[model samples]
Target chain A: MNLFKLAWKNITHNPLSLLLNMVLLTLGIGLISFILSVNTQLKDKFEKNLADIDLVIGAKGSPLQLILSSMYHIDAPTGNISIDEAKPFLREGHPLIKRSVPLSMGDSYKGYRIVGTDHSILELYDAKASEGRLWSNLLEVTIGSVVASNLDLGLGAKFQSSHGFNDDEDLEHEHGTFVVVGILEPTGSVIDQLILCNTESVWEVHDHHEEAESAEEEDHSHDDHEEHDHEHEHDHAGHEHSEYEHDNHDHRNDMSRSQLLEHGEKEITSILVQYTSKTNFQALSMPRNINENTDLQAASPAYEINRLYDMMGTGTRALQLIAVLIAIVSAISIFVSLLNSLKQRKYELSLMRVLGGKARTLLSLILLEGIIMSLLGFVLGILASQLSMAAMAGSLADRYNYEFSSWQWHGSEWYLLAASVGIGFQAAVLPALMAYNTDIHENLSDA
Target chain B: MLKTSEIRHSYKGTQRFTFPEIKCDESSSLMILGKSGVGKTTLLHILGGMFKPLSGDVSINGTSIYTLRGNNLDTFRGQNIGIVFQKPHFVQSLTAEENLMLAQKMAGNSVSTNTVHELLQQLNLDHKAKALSYKMSQGEQQRLSIARAIINKPGLILADEPTSALDDENCKKVVELLEDQSEQLKAALVIVTHDNRLKQYFKNHIELS
Candidate 1:
């Protein structure tokens, strides 16, 4: 009997048409909601991953991709800068710089990425293991929750890595098997998708593979390397071939351990640094200025991830505009249907007029119907958006190294709610006026 | 309270009918009996402020109805007149109570649920309050239409061929409902019909030749 009831009944006067209208609007709202939800998730995950590092220092290239591949488990490293060249920044006793966490990726264990870093990187990032402690030796590995779950990996488990993003890449490494020592919890951070281990571990297995290759070569023609002369010392079987003999061939004879590290002889992948204090940022001017200003490109992960989000701005806004445009179109449809009903409703209009309705009262009733339907539609739309976000979280998180939870309503979501209701009322006004201005006697007689 | 002065009108692209001047007030029932196409509808349209004549005017009390237009005309028409069309129209979407409630809203007056209940009781339609217009029998719908017409207590009741489609039993029931409702509202009643069977129900009769 109220204006809203009347308007709603009228909007749905033709049941199929009203359902068609709701379905169209629901889809429009659903698309915008999905984008908005993903945008929120992407921005949030990037910000969360950046929590471990104050900055990334590396070879000059795309800073965002560098962060994506190195800090997060997406993309490929932009090629390693020599540790000898990077040694000044990693100076163990530097007055201003704290310890750096080096990361080497591009190896995978059955599709899950393996990240090589020191145990200090785990402590520095506050990465608490879900099961045991961080990797203590070369072959030992500590992996992320998603990696463990997906690979069905546990402590004491061992696996071999192939090269690059897919299995088609090189599996020719001489050293392959890595033992899992620890597993991290699902923090919903990039760490959840990573397999973290020590830097020397990358070189150790590959070093063994090189030794085995030389041993097998000696068994054959053996002319490729002349110094690798193995006498028939087969008395101890697996222990008889000197492991130290092949290690000596590729390593430096003149350089000491510190000098070997300084000259890039002991290779590591990428380094993540945290400034001990704000003042320390100013003190590390040479490396910072060099990375940003010189041939090498070091980036603050926060800045570049935000830049990537900014790049996605146009696509998100366009989707939102399309959603609102369709909602407005739906509102217009409501108006058209109501006005059409007015002509055939003359006798009913005259009867209403005769019964006691004022012009303004009739107008209010007509307008109220549109508002009611829009409000209902708005409620339905928001529900659709929430569910869409949950569905996208898994695939996007796995592939893009990001996740979207419930969208925070204070930002763009508020605008969506307003646009729907405003469109509803805007559609109602014209039809209401038409109903109000109808000629009573002409209509009654015609009826 | 309802009266018409000397009024003249002609239809566009036609010249077949002329209407005689007639006035009916409260305390009387005016039945204008005639064959089809004698301008009874045109005269009804002029009296309800639905049309402006080529000459003369309609008045309520002493105020000219022709003075109102647009929503003002709508408001004046709703507050002063009750109309029952020949077909007894009702919005298909609304229930009987809702149709009556709409009439009350249109006159800018508050009619209580009790008022609607009591009016429905008088028309013997109280039991059918929740029925959709089309769901009710034709006789029931005609009664519900009458219930809707008087919800706002307009000063005049205009029913055009109210019983035209009914059988003898139902037509008598419809005329009785109309007569009883006009007396209850103190509305001057006017019924335009070609059927002479309705002459016995009205005190004042205007025949158009």
Candidate 2:
């Protein structure tokens, strides 16, 4: 009876053509929506984790890799930098640096990185303990919110750190058992996926591991020497070996925290430096100066992330172009289907005029049909995008340890809605005009 | 009540049509008979207010239909006149009942499902009310067409070759239905056709060309 009802009826009259048009439209809109959401979340996460840190100084390698490893925690470190060599930057009261948090990483638990860092790292991300308290002792650990939930590790939970980032039982360190002391509130940054402990814990775990290997080697060498030595010489070597074992035991058990850090060639993965004055000349020149003059490399996270985006933009642009092309094709399909239906329904349209319906009524009916189809397609496309994103969220989090919210609405989707309706209007104009200009006398006379 | 005066029309690159004057009072019926090419359809269109005459007036229910233009004329026609065409055209997607409701809605009348049901019952099409219009048999479609034409309760009903595609039994049945409905509404009825079998049925007749 109403124009909307009439329009709906007309479109539903040919179910196959309607379904085809709707499917094509849904695909186009869904792809565009999916891409937009992913792009937004990626940019959001990168910017949030960029934080107040001005530069990352690490062992020389790809500047982008240094930033990814140090700032985003999604890549392996370039290598470790000796703490003695990095001492000037890591100094507590250096004039150019407001704060420096040194990272010593080469350990993980169940694929989540265990970052051995100072408490300053929490202050850098504005993080606070949501449960218990921050790590103060050599073996006590504070977990990020995501780390705590993912590993189901609450306060007082103890687990041995794996030697590397992967979850390998053989590589699990036997020398150190880390007890979870605190869980940090979600900061919406890379910090949310890290486990923080004092830097000495990493050194202690690896130092014990190396000492064990060295003792095994010394015992093997003594056996070989015994096969070639006189009894008196072998007895003399046995006395020296026990003396060396006694010293090694003392070295392992008696070293204090300060002695451990200041001992021969201590190393850390990276130094995350925040400037006292961000816009000053020293802050601006620091990365280039370090890259050119020192053995270390300093990467600006902002600069490197921009380059990353530029690299990703090309693929995104290509996908957007393809989605647009699909949208155009869908519009054409709408036009073709409407025009074909108009041809078959010419007599019916003319008959409406004979039934005392206005010419504009017929015109609007056609327009309404197109608009209705496009709106339905748009709704379904949005739902499809959200559902697919939700389905992919688990794997994406497993890979990047970043949360991808499936149902976030973006402003651009409004523009997409308008564009969809515009496409529908454009497609229906010709058919609607044809309906408006129907010749009642000619059409009715023929029958 | 319907009347026309000196109605005429012409299409581009076609012959001009000069139509005879017509008048029919309330509850009366008139048959305008002519072969094809004589503009039998043209005269029906003018009387139905679908065609503007070259220079004439068509008045239904004492209002000059042609004098009203554009939407006013459309509204006037919808309120005062109902039309049934041969071959039983419909909004094919709608059911038989919905098509009847559409006529009432388009005519700017309140849609009364009761009236639609009663008309379908009178036309012997009540059983097919929910059936898609195009799915019905030819005779049933024709009866449904009559149901749509009178759903708005117009002052005048115009039939253009209404019985041309029907058989002898169906043709007689359709004309009688039209007559009976027109009498019930007390509306004037006008039938334009080339069929000679209708000659014995009409009380008043005009031949064109």
Against the native complex, each candidate's DockQ, computed on alpha carbons, is 0.47, 0.73
For the predicted complex of model 1, DockQ is 0.47
After TM-score superposition, the amount by which residue A66's alpha carbon in candidate 1 deviates from its true location, in angstroms, is 3.2
Which candidate number would show the highest DockQ if scored against the true structure? Answer: 2
**A1-447, model 2: which lDDT tens digit per residue?**
789989999899899999999999999999999999889988988889988788999999999999998898888899988877787788667888998888989888888898888778988899999999988666778999999998999999999988777789988888879999999999888898999987767766766655555566667776555443434333443344345435545554322333334532557899999899988997799888888988999998888899999999999999999999999999999999999999889998877776678999999999998899899889988999999998888778877676889988889889889989988999999999999998877777776
Report, for every candidate in turn, its global Cα lDDT versus the true structure: 0.71, 0.85
For B1-209, candidate 2 gives per-residue lDDT tens digits of: 78888877888848888888899999999999998999887788888887777888888888988778777877787778888887788888999999988888887788899999998898888999999988999999988888888888888999989999899999999999999999999999999999999999997999999
TM-score of each: 0.74, 0.91
lDDT string for model 1 (A18-135, tens) is: 7766776676766776676676666776777786576787777878878888887678888776676667656566565576767766677666777776665665556788798777
Chain A TM-scores for all candidates read 0.77, 0.88
What TM-score would you give candidate 2 relative to the actual structure?
Answer: 0.91
The TM-score obtained for chain B by all candidates, in the order given, is 0.92, 0.96
Query: Residue B90 of candidate 1: its Cα lDDT?
Result: 84
Candidate 2, DockQ score (0 to 1): 0.73
